[model samples]
Target: MEEANETIVAEFMLLGFSGVHDKLQMFLFFVLLLTYLVTLTGNLLIVFIVWVDHRLHTPMYFFISNLSFLEIWFTLVTNPKMLLNFLSDSKTISFLACMAQSYFYFTLGAAEFILLMVMSFDRYVAIYHSLQYAAIMKQRLCIQLGFVSWVGGFLIISSWMVLVYKLRFRGPNVINHFFCDSTPLFQLSCNDTQLIKRVDSILLSSIVLTSLCLTMISYASIFYSILRIPSATGRQKGFSTCASPLTVVVMAYGSCFVLYGRPTGYLSLEINKGVTLLNTVVYPFLNSFIYSLRNKSVKLALRVAFSHNKTKLFPKLCCAP
Candidate 1:
C-alpha cells in the first residue's frame, strides 16, 4: 500500500561467503581480486591485439574483439563488489544498486549469448561459404551484427527489469547468495512470483534454446561440409577453427541451464551461490585463456605484437643515456 522506495528495504545484506572462516574469507578476497585483474588484462589484451594489428582485420577477429570487450563489462559488474564483500563487514547493497546490478549483469550476459551465436554463424559462413566469406562478412556487416548483439541484450533484459520492479520486497533483506542474481532477488519478493518465475523460465529458455539450436544447425552443416573435404589435413583444420567457440558455447549455456533454467528457480540458494561464483568469476577468466591459447592466429598475433613492443622499448632504454 505504501510508496515503492518507502516499502522496500533500504539495503540488502549480501551474505557472500560470510559462513566461511575469517581466514578463508580473506584468502577468497585476494583470490577473487587476482582473478578479476587477470580477466580484465586478458580480455583487454585480446581487444588490443585485434585493434592494433592489421593482420586481425577480419570479421572473425572483429567478433572476437567485441566478445572480449563484452567480457570486460560483464566481469566488472560483480567481481569488484564481491571482493569488497569478502573483506568488509558491510556486505550490503542498496535496493536501487541491487536492481542496477541485476539489470546490467543479465543485459551483458544476454549480449554474450547473442554475440556467441553471431560468432558461430560467422564460423559457419567462413567454412561453408569460404569463397564468399570475405564479401558476406565484411566490415559493414560485422559492425551491424555487433550492433544488433549489444542492442538486443538491452531490449531483452529491459522487460525482466520491469517485472522485477513490479514485485514488492518487504523485509528480512538478507540474501543468502553473493550477488544480486534473479533467483535470490525473486526469493526476497513479498508478492506472488508465479508470473516472474514463468517469465524468467520462458525468457531464459528462449534465449538459450534459440541460440543453441542455431549453433547446432550451423555446426551440423559445418560438420557435413568439413567431412566432405577430401584432404585429412583440411578436415582437421576446419574442426580446429571451431573448437574454441564451441567450447565456450558449451560452458556458457551449460552453466545457465543447470543453474537458472527452471520455472521454480534454483532449488538451493547455497549451491546457487557456489555455482554462480564459478559462472560469474571463473568463466570469464577461462574464456580469454581459451581463446588465446587455442587459436593459433591469436597466439601468433600476440607474439608479434609483444615482440614489436619489446623491440621499440629496448631501443628507447638503450639510447636514453
Candidate 2:
C-alpha cells in the first residue's frame, strides 16, 4: 500500500516501433533516411529552380515555390527525430519539446492547406478573370495572400493548442504514434477532454471543409471555363495550368480528413502512423515530381535553369578549347 505512488510524466517516450526486430528496424531506418533526404532534396530543388529561373516569376510559379519552401521546413519538423529513433534505442522527447513539435507540425501543415486554397483562388482568377488577373493579383496582393496563408494556419491551430496546453497529463507517457499529434495527446490526458475534443474537431473540420469547399468551387469554375474554350489547343493549355495543384489538393485533403476527421482509437494509431508518413514524407517527394514533370512550363524552366548552370560550371566544355 505504501508503494502505490503515481509518478508524474516529465518526459514522453516515443514508442516508434520499439518492438520490431533489429533487421527490420535497420531496413526501415535506411528506407526512412532515403525518403527524408529525397523529400528534402526534391522540395529544395523546386524552390531553387523557381528562384534561378526568372521566367517562373509569375503568380502561379510564385505560389508553387512558396509551397515548396513551406514543405521543406514542414518535412524537417518530424523526420530527423524519427530517423534518430530507428538508429538508437533512446526515443524520448521532453514534455515541452513534444508540445512544441506538435505545435509547429500542425502550424506548418495548416499553412500548407490554406496556401492550397490561395492557389485555387489564384487559378480561378487566371481562368475566370483572364484579362484582369494580372491587375487583380498584383505583387503586393500576392505577398498579402502568402502572409495570410502562413499566419491564418498559425492562428487556427494556435486556438486549439492554447486549450490543449492547459490540459493535465499524468504518468504512462508513451505516445502511440511516432510524433506528438493531438489525438495521442488527448488520449494521454488525465483530465476531462470532451470540451477540448469538440473544440479541436470544430476547428480542424472548419478549416479543412472551408478550404476543400473553396478549392472545389474554384476548380469547378476553372473547368467550366476550360471546357467552353473554342479551340482545342486553348482548352488543353487551360487544363495544364490547373493539373498540378488539383493533384496536390486531393492528396493533401484525403490524408488529412481520413486521419483527423474520423474517430480514432489505439487500434488505429499504427494505421495513422503509416498515413502520416505518406503525408509528410512521400507526399512532399511526389509534389516536386508532380509540379516539375507535369507542367510543361516548369519542365522548360528547369531545363533552362540547368543548362545555364552547366554553362557557368564548364564553359570550356561548350567552347571546346
User: Total clashing residue pairs per candidate?
Assistant: 0, 0
Clashing pairs in 2: none
Could you tell me the lDDT of residue 25 within candidate 2?
A: 85
TM-scores of the models, in the order given: 0.95, 0.94
Sliding window of 10 residues with minimal summed lDDT for model 1: 261-270
- The total of clashing pairs for model 2 equals 0
Give the per-residue Cα lDDT of candidate 1 at 8.
59
lDDT of 2 by residue, 76-116 (tens): 88888888888767789988888888999999999998999
lDDT of 1: 0.88
Alpha-carbon shift of residue 142 in model 2 (angstroms) = 0.5
lDDT per residue as tens, model 1, 1-321: 357546657789999889999998888888889999999999999999999989999998999999999999998889888888887788899988999999999999989999999999999999999999988998999999999999999999899889997777888799987888887788788889888778787888777789889988998899999999999999999999998899899999888877877545435767778788888899999999988877888999999988788878898774676
